[model samples]
Target: MFTTVKELTEQSVKSGLPLSEIMIRSEMDTTQKSRDEIYHRMEKNLEVMEKAVDRGIHEQVRSHSGLTGGDARRLQTYLKSGRSLSGDTLLQAVSMAMATNEVNAAMGIICATPTAGSAGVVPGTLFGLRKRMQPTHDQMVRFLFTAGAFGFIVANNASIAGAAGGCQAEVGSATGMAAAATVELAGGSPEQSADAMAIALGNMLGLVCDPVAGLVEVPCVKRNAIGASTAIVAADIALAGIKSKIPCDEVIDAMYQVGRLMPAALRETAMGGLADTRTGRELKQRIFGGRAQNPAVEEK
Candidate 1:
């Protein structure tokens, strides 16, 4: 629970503290904090995401398994070599990762911060942000605060767990959060932030959680990158002042409704979507061996 941006900003003005300092202090003091706890938590999560990006970038070089590792590494190397990675490169990294392996690397990045299963989205978003705009730590914190509010709204109204609300809940929620953050960083108002979130969620509604062989591989990994990209696009559109006909709250409600309509097979059970096919089973056997059993078949 965290105070709204309006409240936090007003309080900062009253206390004669810079808005950024107030945000940082509030983040550091997480115990028994007011509704503003969400802001603190999101900042904490973003810190985690930054660490994860370091790890992910290193992992790409070490394992040589990530999508277009050489290309991404080249871009990363250029950044380390004194050239900054652009937003386009960040977006390409996500797309390449998704195209290379469906496992959600960006979600893996986010899980390093938010949830292990949904790690990639936040980092992907942050990477894009760093590329597009070099905001100060305080600006980043404010952006995160706005994003956290959207995440809180989604959690309060719908669900973020894949099992509970499908992949849409996990990746979709991340996208909405990222989108809102992007909007704020791009100087959009709260209403625009909300609209970006709504658009992101609306586009990803009802996406099934169908990790192959019950692993957060396959579609999960790729989905995270895709989710990140979608969030950016959504935010950019909203920042341009394009309003979504549906409000953010209503979009969250729609997500919940769609989640309810999803079949159990599509809700992280690996019984449907790409997980249930013969190819998926073969891939599972190749990766996990004979111990893997199709839960659907076992139940029957």
Candidate 2:
């Protein structure tokens, strides 16, 4: 029923319900499903994400296109070295984010936090938080529902599809959702959670969906890593009493406008941005056997 972050937060505050419970009730009301059914479904999603993160970090699986792999393992090793300048949780989150995306690239099972292309942020942050928060299993599941709450608003008010709103809509929204959920998990208020989302989304407002070789590798995986890292920082900012001047809903609307203004080549068509770089073009040719230019665009 809530269509904006302001409305969602106000409702949560007024009803004395956590954002996650509000989201769960919305899902139940919309689908006419029992609370147990909805919670079990989300639990299954969490299980899948955990497995994918475990598999990605522990194994060396390569994508069929040979575009991306192994970086997640490398990140994990780096994190264990005690030499990384990044904070422990931050590095772990980036690694887990990379791990999840690597699994996606390898075509392994992953729960699309919102979408397959930007699936890494939520689980990545959650698993990383386990090392710090040691949350109960049920608490972890609630984290996901909290994320779902923000994601629901974003998808309805703006977009979550890269083909529609570019990477800002995908990784951007995922990171924003993760940041909001992170605030809640860290025991921040619902208002702080909303501020976290606003900060995260405001920072990632104009990311383009420029997948090289039409594969969700390359920049996509790294972008997820960056998004996770950014989420942690944004959560910190919000929890520290800093607030976004532009509200969350307005930021999302701005992201949608920016995405609409983006050229078609920047959207998922792979004709611009990094997709058109020399190395990117060569890699595409090496992988797909040609430029793989759109036939209609070629004709036009």
Candidate 3:
């Protein structure tokens, strides 16, 4: 029944329920599944995320194109050294987010928060919050439900597909979801959670899905890491009582419009942006050996 951020927020604020609970109740009502069943399913997803993060950091995961890998391990190593410019917690989340995408690039199994391209943000922030807040397993699971709630709104109202929209819809929506869930995990109000989403997504406007060499390596992995940081900061801002002047739904609408207006080259066609740079093209030619598969653009 809660198809919009406004409706979900009103339901949560009026009923004195957390956004997670609102999402759970909606799941129960629509699917006729008991609360425990839904929670169990979500718990399985959490386990998958945990496994991906662990494996990504533990093992040297390399992509087929050999474009991304080992960066997560390097960051984790720096975090352990205590010499990182960013604190351990932020670096941990960033590393974990990079970890997930590293696994994805290596063709490992990953739970897409909304899309596989933006898979890292939600779990990265949740596990990062765990480092600082020490949330219990139940709290972490509920955090996912909260993320799912916002993700649901984004998928329904806007777009979560890189081809349909861009990286803004993929990573942008995931970052917004993580921000809202982070607000709830930090005990912020549902309204504040909405503001967190708005701020996070607003910061991500106009992001394009221009994968170098038409592969989800290069900038894609790093972007996921940055998305996690952006989500965390956006949550902090919302918890600190900052509000986005534009409403969440309207921001989503604007994103959709921007996506619609985006040049086809920017929407995962890999024919524009960083994908077309001299080094980007060189990297593509190096990796795929002139076999980079960007069907949208005819190869010369």
Candidate 4:
């Protein structure tokens, strides 16, 4: 098991380093990379994602793809407006992106750490915290570190991929990450951070991946935003010092169990739920190709 943030913070204090620095150091150690290397890797990942989105948009236009145009445009608008996009916008963008293969926008957005197609939820929650609290750089970094820690735990113990663990992995993991980050930002103890994570994960457990198509557009994007908002709410409640009967570890285990019990058709394969409907099949045929139309419609 990982050490609590409180223990780590105390060690940092004893060592005369900032809490954020200590947290970063801990993460670096866990990943077997130096702090500079980790930072550089994250920066490079972000840059790559940005380039992918740009190329994806161009490809979509060139291919005359029927993918949702609103998502990329909305994200661009939100970034350009100088005012943060509402959580709703973020959610809608992610869900829409998931339902289409248009330039892999959903994957790109997830790379942005917004919600993960599911991307908007985590970033939206962080953005909300930034607007509401205006914390210093160190504070923001610490909060992100705390969030990352929880994410690592989830990745290790449960899952984060919709294909592997259903929507619970994507949305539930984002919610847990955001909840822990929120608690840390709000000056809650390490235990509180864990509690927040538990609450978020518990609430989102067993969420099915019901994308309207094999694409990452429709409900995936919007659901991310909703998950992000809920993470914030869960964190707020945890920060109030209310403890749950179940521990964070137990909640994570429960999520894993639930995910395993989910049907294969509901795991983002577009075979069940919303993805199996007549409308969904028609949409897929229109966007991709069909049995009659050369079956090889290349995805942009």
Highest lDDT: which candidate? 3
Name the TM-score of candidate 1: 0.74
Clashes of 3: 0
Q: In terms of TM-score, which candidate is stronger, 3 or 4?
A: 3
Between prediction 2 and prediction 4, the one with superior TM-score is 2
Candidates by lDDT, descending order: 3, 2, 1, 4
Residue 210 deviation, candidate 1, in Å?
0.4
Tens digits of lDDT, candidate 4, 108-138: 3235342345655554565545546787755
Per-candidate TM-scores read 0.74, 0.96, 0.96, 0.73
Clashing pairs for predicted structure model 2, backbone only: none
Candidate 1 lDDT by residue in tens digits, 77-185: 5655655544564564364333222223333433332345566675677565675588777677676655555666577678888898898898888888888777767
Residue-level lDDT tens digits of model 3 in 68-129: 99899999888888898878778888999999999999999999998888999888888876
List all candidate RMSDs to the true structure: 6.3, 3.0, 2.9, 5.8
Off by over 4 Å in 2: 291-300
Model 3: CA > 4 A from native: 290-300
Tens-digit lDDT track of model 2 for 88-121:
8998999999999999998899999899999999
RMSD of 4: 5.8
